[model samples]
Target chain A: MFMAPPATDIAPRDPLLPRIVRLRGKRREIRGVWSLEVVAEEGEPLDFAPGQFSMLTAFGVGEVPVSVSGRTRDGIGLVYTIRAVGAVTAALCGLRTGAPLGLRGPFGAGWPLEEAAAREVTVIAGGLGLAPLRPAIEAVLAAGGRLVLLYGARGPSEILYPADLARWQSARRAQVEVTVDHAGPEWHGHVGVVTRLVPRARFDPDTALALVCGPEIMMRFAVSSLREAGLSDARIFLSMERNMKCAVGFCGHCQFGPHFVCRDGPVLGYDRLAPLLRIEEL
Target chain B: MEIHDLEEVLRGHPFFEGLEPQLARLVRGCARLQRFDPGQRLFREGEPAEHFYVLRRGRVALELSVPGHETLVFQTVDAGEIVGIAALVPPYRSLYDARAVARTVVIAIEARCIRDKCETDPRLGYELMKRLVPVLFQRLRATRLQLLDVYGAPGD
Candidate 1:
């Protein structure tokens, strides 16, 4: 789903302070996972890049980094898909419609959508990693370009965004292949790591951009698989997650080697991260 | 199916992508089409795995039955993939019960026929082993990944 373009542009607010928002909608995606839609309490729309994240606060429970899953044209509403594994996220997931919460940022760099218009795009996501990549996937689809999606989950029930995946598969330009790590007799889909599907996806490695996000270990394997499939390190992008606070470079809490994940990335190129990714405990 | 058609199917299958025509013909007599209804067992654990199957259509779940708990499906093999690879090695007994999760079709190749052909022509034996080795390695790698529980494991 998409919204209209911004009608009136407002001045950017302080990056540190949180703006209050009201929960407009919520849907349970799976056990312990929720897709939340919120509009600023003052009616200011959230204009964020597809892969950028917001610092969501549950009042007293504290703030956590939640990526923007969807947004409307005028920014009147913002969507986030969150899994309640921690205190803050658990609190956010428990809220009912009209509940008030705090939001900060549309922070961090986003996927390279502008440069990807002419290239074939292949997106590889595992489990909740799809949430951050959802916006970029929608943007690529909206541009009317072809996309190949290879997704892996723990099992059938752990799959996120089933309806959206079906809709994208129905589109002529998108090819979706999903696999699970394991399943019972009831499941007929492919069973294996998401990386196994890389060789099966149809795309020219010479002119393709690969977007990947998921558990750290899964991302590492995906990089290897994409490389084996003939993609260069420069052609791959990943969303790197780390402990983030302050949402700006000043805090240094989200430090990843020399870079700050909050400001320098959450989205980074594999070319630059190759050496770092090889370093243990970096 | 006629010998001509069966050989044609083997030739066209991805598994035989680059096998020599003569080499493919050597094992053609040992091949036949088989189907299993949904929920039917293709092979049971501890049984002699006399034939390895190349799935032409449908899905098969390789499972282990444990007392007092639900069956554990460690892997699900899809169309175009091979199953029952144990037939190629010593103590050729199935390690799991391969059950058809849906109506399925496979090209069953008798292990004895393949082994005999290999003995007669060293090249044919080497070529078949070359292909089967990779499938075995891939399955091993997949099982290792499954044990990691990458999706549900605790980590961002």
Candidate 2:
């Protein structure tokens, strides 16, 4: 069990504090029902493994945890697909380029990308679940490993990073497939839940690690779908979504069984989430 | 959708059964419909306030954790019952997690939106309070019973 540190020894950054070097929101756009990408200001360099998340603070409103979209030496992209139902998100929508914003950290234990080096990788994204897995896609591409991506969204408009999608399709380094919950007249892509896209990919579960993110219901379905496709619980991984106040595990808000979403993971193997995930509630 | 049409949809709900049409419409205007499959989480404990939902179809399980990390199902909501009223109170975070046991449909109204509208119209707010208070106390009573079960003989 992890214990909280002494308050004096660890003067954690106050999100509400007026720090001179502040991050600003470049723009906010609705990619789907509750998903938006906020390009934040460059403060300190963000060094995080793929699948870690940061807490976004909008002054006088409140703070929310969003996935670290990507990072380059120049700056990092903080992509948050917010369900615009609350005060912070409602205010977050109103923010523009150069508006003040607070950032806590790129916290949480990320996916074990290093542990699965030189292996076949299968990444599955359900609905807006793609937001957290974008970094891993970038990492896999950078490493030149054999990879496959299966993306599922509500529909065409709900699909994120279309330009990136196009680039991946053209480069053809990794096989990519997309599906939708409901299709419009323009959509000719696969029409079904993201789980359906898994069977189309060619991979050996023994040689591949599957990473999935999205709504808990969708993730549950995706895991079962992958297993049905011959993947085992040990080879499947998932990123969890829960309320986190202190991005660092100081608060118990993110606790799920023996693990905390902020500490042990926002990303964890199925071995952890499977049993708890099987529970009808929680 | 027109606010009035929204009210009619929720008026039949036991949670809002006695609410005036205008107030019911206000609730409806603030609501968004959500659909989830069986065994899906509706919300988790300690999550920041967002919306309160009324089940239209299916059932939702309310769960609380024990000392050993074992979760106990306190109750389940059938059609016409409300969930997430904790959003109406201050600090606006869930005290327990709720999940779906079947393909569920819910009318979720943003708590902030309803609260703001209520602040502007105290009469409507007063009526909502009248409805919610008893439900809150009843839940507390139910939780008390659950605690008794936990502390009582091995199989109660």
Candidate 3:
């Protein structure tokens, strides 16, 4: 059975220190989302893995652990897709060209891409969950496997990366299916929860690996559907989130039970998480 | 479609997988092929529900209309999906509108005919219920999840 992927160093070298970065570029992704490209002002680009997150600080506003969206290994810099929900995120969204921000460890485990070699890969994302999975999706695409991407959003306007989705659909090896919970008259595409599309995805139950990210409720349904489709807990992986006070394990604020979300996870295999997720209030 | 063809299709449909050949033949008696042009309405809200459909090709959208807004498409049923299942339950009336989103073909089964078959044969009724219940359960579960409003507001 497949085990959880090794975390990219649970604690960064200078765990307490924040590397200052400057926002090199920014773009509005949707109605309330922004994609910001930040580059380290001094050090080398943070070589992060898919599903890892970094502690981002907006001057004196506040700090939040945001997932590394993409460009992790691209040689350029890192990309963080922020939704203006809370204070720290809203501050990060308002930054302009050359604006300064503090960044720390690209922490936690990532999707099991190395072990997934030669296997069919299925990616399922809901809402902003697609951000962290995007790097892995790009890697899987470059590695040339039968890749299927199933994504769901709240509505038509909330759908992210239309250009990228269309481009991925054009790739010979990838099949992309997008659905939404709601759609207006202008949308002629599929309308339903992402899990509904799981039954129609073509993949080998024994050889395919599935990655899922979204709210806990969405992941619960997605995992159940994937299980019904014949995948074992060992073959599925999901990214988890909690209120992480420190980017390191010392704080213990993000502990699920014994493991800390900041260090032990953020990305975890279903086999390790299934039981915890089943508890009444864990 | 020819009775023989319809029986064969029913025998092999995923929804009816493992159904006895005799039962498939009985279902075929109440089944007929239907083709709907793109934008055609299969059934509308408040209409009497006389039949259910198993999509053979193309897609259908389950929609709802608001007083001042454009029709809302809640779900799309693709090939192999069973639609208009409201026909099988009490107060048999379509709750919402189902329209063909593309040139669609389906095996429309007369609900009353099947219900009558189920009445005479308890085992047949049990078997049919065994299959149909799962479909209802799945659709209801999907609806519940969609209603959670996971993305109703901007969230991290």
Best by lDDT: 3
Ten contiguous residues with the weakest lDDT in model 3 chain B: B147-156
DockQ of each: 0.57, 0.01, 0.68
Native-interface RMSD of candidate 1: 1.9
- The lDDT of model 3 is 0.89
Q: Is 1 or 2 the stronger prediction by lDDT?
A: 1
- On DockQ, the leading prediction is 3
- Residue lDDT tens for model 3, A171-260: 998889999998876777899999999998999999999999998899999999999999999999999989887878998889998789
Q: On a 0 to 100 scale, what is the lDDT of residue A228 in model 1?
A: 84
Q: How good is model 1 by TM-score?
A: 0.92
Residues A1-282 of candidate 1: C-alpha lDDT, one tens digit per residue? 899888877776899999999999899998888989989877866688988999999999999998898874456798999988888988999999999999899899989999777778999999999999988999898898789999999989999999989999898988899998877767778777887788779999999999999998889888988998999999999999998899888988889888999998999999989989888898
Show where candidate 3 strays beyond 4 Å. Answer: A1-13, A72-74, B154-156
Tens-place lDDT per residue, model 2, A1-282, is 999976694577674343322333333334313333444344444466788887777789988887766653355445555555567866665666566667667788887788655777899886556767877888777778677899876556667777777787765568988765543323434544565566568898778989888767667767877887888898898998889888777778888888888888898999777788767657
RMSD of candidates 1 onward, in order: 5.2, 21.3, 5.9
Model 3 reproduced share of reference interface contacts: 0.80
lDDT of 3 at A98: 97
* Residue pairs with backbone overlap in model 3: none
